[model samples]
Target: MGEWDLRRLRVLRAVDECGTVTGAAERLRLSPSAVSQQVSALARQLGAPMLEPYGRRVRLTPAARLVLRHAELVFGQLERAEAELAGYLHGEAGEVRVGAFATAIAGLLVPAIARLRESAPRLAVRVVEAEAAGAYGLLAAGEVDLALSLAVQPGGGDPRFVQSVLLSDPLDVALPPGHPLAGAPGLRLADLAAEPWIYGAAGPWREITLAACADAGFVPERAHTAADWTAILAMVGAGLGVALVPRLASARRGGGAVVRALPADLPTRRVVAAVRTGTQGTPPLRRVLDALAEVAATVQPD
Candidate 1:
């Protein structure tokens, strides 16, 4: 048989639905002769009779019934494809991969994903836990659609990525419960100058801790080194030393420690979302970015 035209298949299905050439033509707003001509053309193309005389009207032949059954499935699939395409065009569907640090995975990305479940249920999000430094590499390599990272120096960020600030997460001091300044009010980073500090041995958190301390005029005496927030908090709780904890991680401060707010001049780390320079405007990427911002707005420092 020659190639089947979808328009002819549609006309055949309409005839089956309406039960007569006149009725199908009236339903389709075409004249009865045009309807008969299309059906006759389709029959010739398929080398089979599609209609037969049945009393004063017409009935489908066996071949026409089989064609209509398969045509129904084809039409259903076409509708589904169109719907999916519409969703992709509107930023409501498709997959988005994101690279974020551990704290961001918990504090921002997870919440943003939850919000997307309600707002864009068909949009799939895949997450990679990566630090600020590595996330940029992932973004550059196109391994991720978005990257949640700590803000780099002013005018020092990569030109290949577009960055947007998500939130400013304050850094608070986690002190052992028995420490002299455990619950101190009006606390300042300078007050902890002489205290032993527990911090990440490397990564952006280490840089943030060291930089904030330097701005306060004293280098913190390193008492322990740990990259995991839970481990650092555990060490602080065990009286191993105080640690600078970002508000983003404060919620996980397990036990035996007191998290205290610093003076109004409290130090903070800027959290940002990054995407490939020009691709930030992409549908799925933009939807994920907007969701992150919405979730970030609800994150308050305790």
Candidate 2:
């Protein structure tokens, strides 16, 4: 054991990786002689030869390799520490960008942000409206710190992200004001099997709707296809077709459409928040996630 200086250890690692003093100097933005001197001092401190010549390049001695291995671990831990410190400093006074679908933006994201403004005034929340898949992409690409999506299993089990289920948003049936099922307290999805259907864009929602309908022994006649819940509801209100709507998305009924809950086991999508694995430790991100959960809890699932 000896007094190990990180600076010297870095110099040794650089020289080992670069294969020459000049190469190490260039990488470290130092003169070649300076790099040599640092390595020399490190050799003296550790009481062991740290480098060996191999042709025109340099190689790490057995002892130097051991030291460098440990040095890498130390450097990594230090980097993580710095990141945590930065997170703490910025948690209450920094900006966090979020990606979410339109309905989440309306029913959960916006309200969560408003709550953040009141509680953490210095923390600014930026939002981008995107669907679940797109939002998850943004999160993976580092374009956003957090994403609100219906895809609870984001990253498909990729270890790079942490997914938290914020809530289970249930799917409801949208009916026109004078429709036969408009006033029903609880309706079986099978009962509407014969009705014209306005389905969402082809994706998870459509899959759930189709699966539920299939379980009910019928296939909905796709009369309209719209991505936006409001648009879907409008189509329903015009008596064009009935559609399945997520409760969070239908916070405000449009086009004179009435929302009716389906049977308990029908269909529901999990509202999940996906973040870079280590970002959940950031104070600001944690605050925003908490606020989202709080707001989501207040939503009365139809």
Candidate 3:
């Protein structure tokens, strides 16, 4: 409690585990007397004895046991804090933690990463491929600095945080290559109303898709209740059924499926960037976000 060195906590825990001053000192690489002195100093600081005699070895006093439990937890957390801070200060091109949803990774984040590699060769951009709905959560908790997420309309997520709408890419229906709609000029959601579909209801995208269908006048016949667009499209490629997907689905090098635009009416989904509420827009994060925006701009809506 008196701003004692962390070593005092370690000495206490080691002695508790090893059950002897000599053994604890050996584990900590300190002399037995030093361990004794440190423990005694800690006891004096706390105004209580932290150890109890037990046969040839020593056991913890009730107070030592209680404090040691908390000490272990505190030390573990402190170690993590130290490592994260180390990564933060790590050289000129330190690691930047980023989190994004899966489709975003395939959509624009991969290109963003490539652009960052080309422009800032030294910056280590650490990416975590997490669910899009969870991306903002990661940013909120300080687990990540930036998040790439999706919303039906721009500026809808975390108004208290900074959001940059990168692209308003159109969503399209992906069908098997030889399917009847493959060569069609365009489609309306009602055009495929009778067709069984596959989708994930884990996020707003699910509700957005379903609500869009309702507005079109028919509830979708869910052929598959699944997550992960790759698997969803794989099911589509198998001709199992068709599903709605974003434009990036076309970026794949053919042979998978055909993406056809929705008829002139349906709203487009806005893909955006969400940075912490007040990042001060440092040059490093600014440069990274700019590179991200540049990548998003290149994503032509098919």
| Ranking of predictions according to TM-score | 1, 2, 3
Report the alpha-carbon TM-score of model 2 versus the true structure. Answer: 0.66
lDDT of 3: 0.77
Clashing pairs in 2: none
| Local accuracy of candidate 1 as per-residue lDDT tens digits, 182-214 | 766778889889999998777788889999999
Q: Would you list the clashing residue pairs of candidate 1?
A: none
How does candidate 1 fare on TM-score?
A: 0.86
- Give candidate 2 misplaced runs (Cα > 4 Å): 1-87, 152-156, 184-186, 264-266, 300-302
Provide the lowest-lDDT 10-residue window in model 1.
152-161
Error of 2 at 291 (Å): 1.3
Each model's backbone clash number: 0, 0, 0
Best by TM-score: 1
Select the stronger candidate by lDDT from 2 and 3: 2
- For candidate 1, give the lDDT: 0.87
Estimate candidate 2's alpha-carbon lDDT, on a 0 to 1 scale. Answer: 0.83
Model 1 / residue 124 / CA error / Å = 3.3
TM-score of each: 0.86, 0.66, 0.63
